[model samples]
Target: MDRRTLLTSSLAGMAAAAASAPETRAQAGGSGPPPFAETMAEMTWQEADAAAKSGASVLWAFGVIEQHGPHLPLGTDVYIPSAVLRRARQILAERGHQAVILPAFYWGINQVSGAFPGSVEVQPATMIALMADVLSSVKKQGFARVFCTSGHGDALHNKTIFDGVTAGRAASGIDAAVLFNAPLVKRLGLDTASPAVLGFEVAESPARFIDVHAGDPETSAMLHIHPELVRKDLLPTLKSTDYGPADLAEWRKGQEAARAKTPLGYFGDPASADASRGAARLEGQAKAMAEVILARVGGK
Candidate 1:
């Protein structure tokens, strides 16, 4: 048999066995937004085999450790998306699809934010190669259906991710779908989908006034997902700074230009952030993504 055919056949038998056998820790009863049920990092090889056998659609997320002004943690990107995907998994399970969360790919290319302190970034090419290799690994592990999600939103960063997906699918022949928020994807204007590299889109938040980095949406998201990580005290003094088209063009001229435009490393109005809005943003984004994944993959 060819690779996909062989893997599918093996899963059919293993799934039957898994269904008849006792539930592993992954299937144990839980409540209230619990941790990932089946993670590659946490599962034993035997348990992972059972997960593979269960035909769970594998999921992985991408983020970066970087400055988000002075109020949010460097891990703001990682925490928010991980929370969103955790909720997405719950929504998927409710719709009768088993999705296993893989450990997140947190290290990422940080171009716009590279000028800031604590911004650990890799070259764009490095990110692209890593994406290709990671997806290839997933395909080799017999996970035929997979999804990639990202929390970071830089146009260049996302492009590298998209290219990596292309290279990975070309190299390994897995049917993987990547998802991103619609506005940023539209802004990037990337031809983001193909048969081999399917992707879905969701709105990152409700309509915002003057939306930009480390602003209301992002700050509120961190407040909702990781409240302790937010510097609530500093929020009161940070003023609103909007970067219009011309302003952004000027800002991107160089790192010094960007830093000069936004001295404290933030843009938009952060003092206006609200945790209630944050909760709603999380629910909206997570639900939109979950619904699409169910429609696209259908428990495959």
Candidate 2:
């Protein structure tokens, strides 16, 4: 069988093993959220080699140091995805799973907010090559599984990263995959071993009338995950920069048009954000991410 096919066929057994694992979430219970210390940057070579030899999985949360409607931090994309992965890490620990969280990759393609002052972007080829190289190196280090995810929503950002992932897997023959944003997962026809599609579902998400960028969904998330980064005074003033097909086309045109379209670099109603809702969505996304990892690593 092909590698993908072999991986698919073994999913059922993996889930069963996870379900019957000795450590239960209840037994692993604690107050507040978890503090993930299994960071690749912090680990010594010997420690990393041991985890790889033990068949541990890993995470790479790609982010963008870009604008978020002038009200959020430049690292909003970085913070949110990294936070989700941290929560996912906690869940995996509860299930007797172990995985290292790689250092945040912040230099990603930024089309939507490119025209804004704080938005940082790079060539598509750079991102693609980076993805391939990273995966290849992960395999060389002996890791058999890895999940690449991000909170950024630019269409090209999604396309380029997936392209990189495919190229990386083909060249290195590694087991690297992505827990892509919900829209791209469906768009690319990718599916996970888990029953639920692990991507972030845009349509059914916490976003209201329109919540793509610094709108309710993202704003509320920051409020819960990193409230200090949010500009409380600005939340009351931000308005909806609603998105549709036309808006998407404009965004894709380039940074100039994107800047013209949303001068403040926002695209949703941040005014409607709620901290409580933010907390719930963070946990929800974390649970889904954890499920994806569990199914991938539990079987072995």
Q: Pick the candidate with the highest TM-score.
A: 1
lDDT (Cα, tens digit) per residue for candidate 2, span 85-202: 8888888878888888888778988877788888888999988888788889999999988788878887778767777777888879887777775667776676645332346443
What is the per-residue lDDT of model 1 for residues 105-216, given as tens digits with 9 covering 90 to 100? Answer: 7788777778889878888788878888888887777788777788887677777777777788888998776687666567767555565334455455454445677889
TM-score of each: 0.82, 0.79
Clashes of 2: 1
How many residue pairs clash in all the candidates, one count each?
A: 0, 1
Off by over 4 Å in 1: 1-38, 196-209
Clashing pairs in 1: none
- Output the TM-score of candidate 1: 0.82
> Where does the lowest 10-residue lDDT sum fall in candidate 2?
29-38
